[model samples]
Structures are given as structure tokens and as C-alpha cells.
Target chain A: MSRQTPLNAAHRKLGARMVDFAGWDMPVQYTSVIAEHEAVRTAAGLFDVSHMGEIEFHGPGALAAVNGLLTNDLSRCADGQALYAGLLNDEGGFVDDVVAYRFSAERILVCVNASNREKDFAWMTARARGCTPVDRSDEFAQLALQGPKAAAILQRLTPVQLSGVGTYRFTEGAVAGVDCIIARTGYTGEDGFELYCAPVRAEALWNALLAAGAANGLKPAGLGARDSLRTEMKYALYGNDIDDAHTPLEAGLGWIVKLDKQDFVGKAALERQKAAGVPRRLVGFELTGAGIARHGYPVLKDGQRVGEVTSGTLGPSVKKAIGIGYVPAAHSAEGSTFDVEIRGRPVAARVVKTPFWKRG
Target chain B: MGNYPGSLKYTKDHEWARAEGSRYVIGITDHAQAELGEVVFVDLPEVGKQVTAGKPFGAAESTKAASDLFAPVTGKVVKANEALKADPSALNSDPYGAGWLVELEPTDGDTSHLMDADSYVKLLG
Candidate 1:
């Protein structure tokens, strides 16, 4: 049986199409993926992301302990800020990509992919020094209110000034009478807030947000819209675009890796890989031919299989078939031509700059 | 939870076929389109292409995934819905009418192997 999130019942009440995602019974869409995708781009969309896991590090050395395990330099984040980072194995390959929220010197929170929850907790607990890592996955339910009108909708329910929270910043406040950690962050490349509240209070929060944002065109989005929205932004999805076998540099996430910082888990391997020059790199492309390139579809160069598509979708907002995949470094440049084999036929494609949809 | 026209014969693969004189009009069932979700592209064969029963002839690509379109009866394609190449959401909106994939001139003119609306509904259940 798949695990149910706190708002599972609420999702069913809203007539959502439910699917098993990362072993959790989550809503894939309430109405349709295209409508929900357009809503986030034009107005606002609310999402239940409670299936994502959260791990808390406590004690005076919390920051240092967590930073040691991450490829990004967490020491740079001030309190009330969050940074995206990669938890890598010693071989410089991703264990999981995560977002670390800095609450204080002693209290830091790491949000991880739902599929890597148990493994990530165990990995951190065994290696953490001078701090206690607690699995708080079941304790909190996460809701993402994303898009242009997110602040206006949220501000109507909370006394906390939404303007005070800048991008990637967070603050503890009460939303609809429920205590929540409101973080100005999201995966959809929209200005939004990710609210973390008690699981018991999730249903109330969800209902309240929907009611508050109804007139503003905020619809209850699901995992399907979430996937397409993030894909347009070229945000890497764990187990697809990034995995335990691929290093962050090869995944086009080198911006998050701060090699100049102190020694981390994958420091030596990353240093070595950087010196040797990364071989294959991830590239975003749009199908110039007839078919939609899907995940696991072979990426070809000169009629030979060179790589595979990691994430692909018909981008509703962009109105094109966009995809991301790995290819040789020579073919990873912008405007480089290749073919994505769709249904045993090679379809022409061209490498393009990522974030397929840019905000006007 | 889809409307299955009683006049059309159905395949277990979720295709619906309607006999039009010697030729048959073919398209996916409403249930199949709903399951696929938001058809973005339809890859139909050329007008003169040959297709065999139970064999895949084309594809319907959705935002989430792609599903193969199987032939319900063996025939030579007399006409292909070229309009779907520009607007495939018609598959979801009108699976029985505007969304018809192809018109096939059946070689055997037999559909005894296919199911009726009642039987297809039962199969769906």
C-alpha cells in the first residue's frame, strides 16, 4: 500500500486524480495538467508537497555538521535563508539534492526528495557530528503557494508581512490560525511561498488557502502540473535528471557547488573530476520534429545512441515539446544539433538554453 | 466513467471502430483518452499505409506519457485525420467524431472479434 499524506482525504474531496508518486498516494491533478500549468504561470496554484521529507539538525554544531555533508557552502546562508544543495557520496555522485533552511546556529532543516527519505536520514545520522539529526517527515505537511498572486492571496490570511520575506528567505508565522514556517521558495520558477505546518493542521490550511485564493485564480495543482512546471524551469528531478550515479557538475548544477569552501563529503572526488574535465553534461532541447521526446528515450548523434533523455514533457506554457538529457560535452553547447529517437525513429532536436519559459 | 457509443465496436486495447460501408472509421475510446490525459500530439500513418489488426499503427503523445494506437481491424488506410497534427486535444474532446484517427478499407470486413459497448463497459469495470 502507498503511504497517504495528511491532506489525502482533502485531495479526494476536491476530485483530484490520485496516483502513486514516490510510494505516496498523491494527487496528480485536480482538473487537467495544462490548465493547472497555465494557472501557475498567469495567476497562482496551490500544491500539497507533504510527501517531501524534512530532517532537522539540532545542537550548537548543527550548521557545521550538515554543511560537511553538502556540496554547497551552507556557511554562506544567513538566518532565515535557504539554499539548494546536493548531498553527494564520496564519489561525487548525488545521494540526493536538497534545500537547507537556516533557522539558527543550532537549528537547520533539510528538505529531501520523498523517495530518498529513509536512506537520507540514515546517512546523515551515521555521519553527523556534534549535532542530533531527527527525521521529522511525518511531523510536518508542506504546501506550496506559487505564482504571481501568491503573496496577495497568502497575505489576506496571515498577519506576517509577505513583503518582508524576500526570495529564498523564510519566517515563522501563523497562517489561518496554524503555525507555519513560510519560506519564499518554490520549484516552479515562480515567486511563491512554501509553508510547513503540523500534519494535523494541514487540511485546514489547504482549505483556507483555496478559499482565500479562489478569486485570484489559484487552483489546487497536483504532481502532474508540478512536474511540467519544474521541467520548463529545467529544475532537476531526483531519480530522473539527477541520481546517485551522476555528479552535480555533469547535471548542469555546478552553480550550487562551492569548491572553494572547506572539505565536504565529495570534495576530493569533485576536485579530481573538475581537474579532469567533466565528460558528458546535461542539455535542454526542443524537438524540431513531430514527436514528444520522453524519459529513457535514446539521444542520438550520427545515428549512434549517445545518451538518454532524463526529463521530457510537452511544456504547456511554452507551447512546445521540451526535454532535458545527457550528451557528450561537444554536443552539450547551445544550438548543438542531435536526434532524440522517438518510437524507433530519430527526431531532429537542438540544444537550447534552459528555463524554457522566462518571466516577462 | 466515459460515454461509450453503443453503435461502435470496441477492442480490448481501447480502440473503437465503426463500419462505414466497406470502410471503417477508427479512433481511441473516451476511456482511453481520459487515461492518457491531454493529448498533445497524434502520430497517424499516411493515407495509403497498411495496418494489421491488433498491431500498433500510430501514437498519441500526452503531456505525461505516450500511448500506442493499435489497429482494431486489418486494412489499408483510406484517410488519416491530418487536423489532429495541428490540434490533438480533439482526441480528448471528441473521441468519436472529430478525433477519428483514420478511415480504413477493411480487407476481410469482419469485426466479430471486437466487443460491443455493453461488453466494453464490463471490461472497463
Candidate 2:
């Protein structure tokens, strides 16, 4: 049986179409995927991101233990700061991509993909030396309020001055009388806050936010809009885009990998790969003709299969079929043309610089 | 459960056939459209193309997944909905009306195979 989130009943009340997402019975869309997606880009939208896992680590050895496992350097991260990091296998391929929040010198919290929760906790626990890695997935309920007007809608509840919170910054405060860890972070390429609260208080907080934002046009978005919005921004979804078979470097996430850091899990393999040069590179493309290129669709160059699409959609904001995939390093440059085989038909497409839709 | 027009016939694959003299107006059932979410693209077979009963003639793509559109009866495609080619969301908004996929001139076929509205509703359960 698929697990249900704290707001599952609320979603059903709103007439959300539910789907089994990574073992969780989650809302895929409340209205339509395009409508919900456009709402996030234009005004504001809410998301029940409670399915995402939160793993905590605390102790004197927390920094050292976490720094050894992640590809990004945690030593430079100050309290109230968060940084995107990659957890890689010994062979330099990504096990999962995570957002590591530094609560203090001895405490840290990592938000991970829901599907990789158990596996990630076990992986980190086995490698941790002095610090204890705790699986706290069930303890927290996460909600995301995203878009240009997100702050205005959320400001009505919390006493904390949101203007002081910058991107990747967070603070502990009460929203609508419920204690929460309000963080300025989001998967969609929009300005937003992720509110992490106790599971028991989720329903109250959800209803309060909806009531407050109802006038400003904040609709309850679901996993469908979340996926499309992230795709438009070219953010890698752990399973579909980045997995054990692909390294962060090849996925165009080299900026997040700090090779200069000392003794991380995948450092050796990454160093060798960097020196040898990456054979393949992830690239973004837009369909020139017709049809959407879906995940696992064959990408062809000169009628020969060259790569495969990892993530794609007929982006609501962009109003075009766009996708990201891997190709030979030689053909990975912007403006290179390719054909994606959709339903046995080769539709012409061209490589383009991604984050297809950007807000002014 | 979604609305199933009593005047139409349904296939197990969730397509509906509305008899219009010699030609039948074909579209996906309301239940199928709801399950598919927002239809981003509706790829239909070209006009005059031969379609066999129970065979996939085209596909309907949503943000979540792609579902094949199966022919309800052996027929020759007389007209494909060109409007849906531009705006496929019609399938979600009005599956029984503007979302009609194709108009086909059906060949000699067994009428007993297709389920009526009551039977289709029962099968859905």
C-alpha cells in the first residue's frame, strides 16, 4: 500500500487526482497540470512536499561526517545557510542530490528525495564515524509556497521578517501559531519558502495558508506542476535525470561538486574522470517541429541513435516542447540539431540553453 | 465515476463511438480523460488511413504519461480533429463534445461487441 501524507484527506477534499508517486499516494494535480504550473510562474501556488525526507545529524563530529559523504564543502556553510550537494557512490555517480542545511556547527539537516529516504539514511549511517545519522522523515511535514507573490501571502502569518531571509537562508519561527522551520528554498525556479512543521500541525497550517492566500490567488499545486516547473528550470529529478549510472559532472552539475574538498566519497573517481575529460555531456533541447520528447525517448543525430531524453515536457510557461538529455560531448554545444524518436517518428529538435523560462 | 452518455457506445480501452449515420464520431470516454489528466498532445491518424478494431491508431500524451488511443471498430478515417492538434486540453474540458478525436466510416463490424452506457459503467466498477 502506498503511504499517504498528512494532507492527503485535504487533497481529496479539493478534488485532486491522486497518483502513486514513489510509493506515496500523492496528488498529481488539483485542476489541470498546465493551470497549476502557470499559477506557480505567475502568482503563487502551494505544494505538499511532505513526501520529501528529512535526515538529521547532530554531534561534535557532524560536520566531519557529513563533509566526507557529500561532494560539496560543508565547512564554509554558516548557520542559517543551505547548499545543494551531491551524494555519490564510490565510483563518482550520484546516489542522490540533496539540500544540506547547516543549523549549527554540531547540527545539520539534509532534505532528500522521498524514494531514496531509507537507502540514503542507511548509506550515511554506515559511513558516519562520530555523528549519529537519524532518519526523521516521519517527524516533519514540509510545505512549499512558491511564486513571485509567495512572500506577501506567507507574510500574513509569520512574525519573522521574511525580507531578512535571503535565498538558501532559514530561521526557526511560528507560522499561524505553529512552530516551523521556514527556509527560503524551492525546486521550482521561483522565489518561495519551504515551511517544515510537525506532522500533527500540518492540517492546521495548510488550511491557514490557504485561507490567507485565497484572495491573492494561491492555488494548491501538486506533483504534476512541480515536475513540469522543475523541468522548465532544468533541475535534475534524482531518478529520471540523475541516478547511479550518471555522475554530477556529466549531468552539468559540476558547479555543485567541489573537487578541491578533501577526502569525499567520490573524490578519487571524479578526479580521474575530470582529468580524462567527460565523454558525454547533458544538454537541453527544444522541439523545432511537433510532438513532445518524453523520458527514455531516443535522441538521434544524422538518423543514428546518439543519446536518450532524461526529462521533458510541453512547458506551460514556455509554450514549447522542451527537454534535457545526454549527448556526445562533441554535439552537446548549443544550437546543435537532433531528432527525438517519438512514437517511432523522428521529430527534429535543436539544443538550446536551458532554464527555458526565466522570470524578470 | 465520470459521466457516460447513454446514447454512446464504449470500448474496454475507454474510447466511445457515437453513431452518426454511415460515419461514427469517436472520442475518449470521460473516465479515460479524467485519468489521463491534462492532455498536452493528441496524435491522430491521417485522414483516409485504415484503422483496425482494437488496434492503436494514435496516442494521447499528458504531463504524467502517454496512453494509446485504440480504434473501437474497423474503419477508414474520414476526418481527424485538427483543432485538438493545437489545443488538446479539450479532451479534459469536454470529452463528450469538442474533444471528439476522429470521424470514421466503419466497415462491416459486429455491433454486439461494443458495450452500452450501463454496461460500461458496470465494467468500470
Candidate 3:
């Protein structure tokens, strides 16, 4: 069954086109993908990200319990700060990606994708060991206020002194007469904030922010806009770009893996793989022929099957067809030559640099 | 509602064809362009190529999705819009005007295999 976000009613009222995304009925677009994508790029865009999972871990054992749960060192995360980390299994394969925020030394909240919520909660609960893990996904909603003008728009509705919130930093503040957690982070490669608050108040806060950002061209953006924005940056989606079968090293996310850190799930295998270096690596490419490369299209290096296109699109930002795929490490360098087998034809494509486009 | 120029013949696949004398200019419809949303890259059909009715001549991809541009009529491609090589968004800007994909010489003058603008618009629903 498809789930609905708390802001579903609000999205409907705005005439958003909705679709089933990973079992959740989410808005894919409001006005249009290009318009919404530009709204976030040029100005500010509000997103109903309430479908994302938010879980709270409290009590004394929270710190130790979460440390073992995630690959990143939670000890490095101070109070009122956030860290992007991955949850891995014993094989060093990623189970899910999340933003871990420390409310205090004894409390932490991890926000994950909606599809991974139940599985993540079950995994955490089975090994609760000493802490109390609460599934707050059903109790809270998340909204991403993204773009260059997002900070100014959100500052008007909240008294949180937004200037002080650095990147990846979060604060407990009040907006729309309700307490909220504002995190200075977003999927879009822009300056923005992700606000977490009570589920019941989602519609009210969404509407209030829309009213405040009206003058700034803030449209209530949706998943369609979000996908394009992130794709422009070559940001990987969970299932499309990375999954449990693939290790972080192969997914081009080796930067997130800290081999020297304390042992976590999948640590040993990752350490060995890191020492030997990855055999296959993920890289981005641009289509050169008369076809739009899509997911599952076989990737070829000199007429040989080397990999397949994982995620691809004609990016709205750069106005070019860009996609990511795994290839042999030797062919992973920028400007390498490769052929994308689109529709059973070897379309000439070059291994361009990842993030086919970047913000100026 | 999207723009449906009264002068152009449209295909159910969202491609619009306008016959200019013996040559025909073809491209995606404004409704199709708006549906695709912010076309960035347009895969233009090669000139002098043989195309069949309902066969995908090429594609125009936007952030939202990539849509195949099917040939409205069976013809031999005479020309392709080269401007879209650097600026494919001309399709989104003017799908019927400067955004014309391929100019073809139709195999037949009788409208045998394509739908009209009104019929195509009704097919969208």
C-alpha cells in the first residue's frame, strides 16, 4: 500500500501532480519541473519532505547504541549538529543513508528515506541493547526550505537567528507557534534548511512558509523538482544510485567511508577493499548521440559491456543529458571515452566528470 | 491547457508536423513540451534518414522525463534543426517554430496514418 505524507492535503490544494514513489504517494510536481527546479536554483523552493523517515533515539545508551548502528563516528557529532552517515550491514554494503543529528549527548535523531523506515527501525530495535529507539516517522513531518533565498524566507517566520546555523548544524526553534528542529542542509546543491516538526502541524507550517516566501517566488516544490535538482549535482538516490548489493567504494561514495574509524558493520570488508582499492567505480557520463540514456541501459567501453547506466536525465540546470554508471576503475577518470548502448546501438558517449553541472 | 496551433498537424505521441510546401517541419507539441518540462537535450533525427509512421525519430529529455518523438508520417528526412545541438531548449521555447526537429518529404500527400490537432488533443486524455 502506498503511504501518504502529512502534507498530502496541502499538496492537493496546490494542485500538485502526485505519484507513487517507493510506496509513498508523493507529489512529483506542482506547477512544472522546470519552473520548480528554477525556483530553487534562482530563488527559494519549499518541499514537502514529510515522507522521509525521522527516528529518535533517547536515554543513556543512545550514543553508544547509535555509534554501532551507523558507520560514521557519532562521537564526532556534537550537540545541535548534524552528520551525514550511512547504515551498513556486515558485508559493508549500505542499507540506507541518513542524516544523524544530536539533540544532546543522550538524544539523537536520524532521518532516513521513507522506504527504509520500517526496516531501519526493526534493525535498530533488535539491537537496541541499552537505548530506547522510537519510531518518530509517524509522529513528525519534514519540510525542506531550499535555495539561495531560503534562509531569508525562513528567518522571517522563525526567531532562531538563522545566521548562526552553519552548514550541517541544526537548532531547536519555534515556527508557526510550534517547536521545530531546523537543519542547515538539503539535497539540492544550494543553501537551505530542512525543518522537522510535529506531523499535525505540517500543513500549517507549509502554508505559513508559502505565505512568507510568496514575494520571493517560492513555489511548493515536489519530488520531480527534487530529483532534477539533485541529479544536476550527481547526487545519488538510494535505490537508483546505491543499494545494499553495492559497497560504498563502488558507488563513488568512498569519501563517506572512514576506514580508520571504529569498527562498524561491513568494516572489515570495506577495509580490505579500501586497501586493495576498488575494482569498479561509479562515474558520470553525457550522451553524445540522438538518444536519451535511461536507467538499465547497458554501458559499453569499446564495444564491450562494462557497466550499465544507473540514473540518467536531461538535466534542467546544464541543459545536457547526464547520467551515472559503474565502470572499471581504469575508465573512471574524467574525459575518458566510452559508448552508451542506447536502444541496442553504441551511442558515442564520453565519461565526463560527475555532477555534469555545478552551482556558480 | 496547452497551446494547440490551428495550422499544425499533431500526432498522438505529442509530435507536431507542419507541411511547408513539399517539405514538412516536425517537432513536439507545446503540450508535449510543457509535459516534458524544461527540455535541455534534444536528440535530433539524422538528415536524409528514412522514417516510418509512429516510429520514434528521436527524443527530447527534460528533468521530469524523456519523451520519444514519433514520426507522424512515413517520409525521408530532408533536414534537421541543427540549432538544438547547443540549445535544445528551443523545443521548449517554440516547439512549432524554431524547435522543428526534422524536415521530411512525405511519402504520400493523403493524411493516411496521422491524427489531426483536435483528435490528438482528445487522445491525450
Tell me which residue pairs clash in candidate 1. none
Per-residue lDDT of model 2, residues A117-156, tens digit only: 9989989988777798999999999999999889999899
Candidates by DockQ, descending order? 1, 2, 3
Q: Which portions of model 3 show Cα errors greater than 4 Å?
A: A285-293, A314-320, A344-359, B3-10, B17-25, B106-113
True contacts kept of each: 0.72, 0.56, 0.72
| Best of the candidates, lDDT | 1
| Order of models, best lDDT first | 1, 2, 3
Q: Sort all candidates by TM-score, best to worst.
A: 1, 2, 3
DockQ of each: 0.82, 0.69, 0.49
The candidate with the higher TM-score, 1 or 3, is 1
Worst 10 residues of 1 chain A by lDDT: A123-132
TM-score of chain A considered alone, across all candidate predictions:
0.99, 0.99, 0.97
Candidates 1 and 3, the one with greater lDDT = 1
Q: What is the TM-score of each candidate against the true structure?
A: 0.98, 0.97, 0.89
Give one digit per residue, the lDDT tens place, for model 1 in A1-360.
999999999999999999999999999989999999999999999999999999999898999999899989889989999999999999999999999999987899999999999999998988777787999999999999999999999999999999999999999999999999999999999999999999999999999999999999999999999999999999999999999889999999999899999778888999999999999999999999988988899999999999999999899989999999999999999999999998889999999998898987
State how far residue B36 of model 2 sits from its true place (Å): 1.8
Candidate 3 residue A148 Cα shift, in angstroms, is 2.5
Docking model 3 quality class: medium
Alpha-carbon RMSD of each model? 1.1, 1.4, 2.9
Local distance difference test scores for all models:
0.94, 0.92, 0.84
Choose the strongest candidate by DockQ: 1
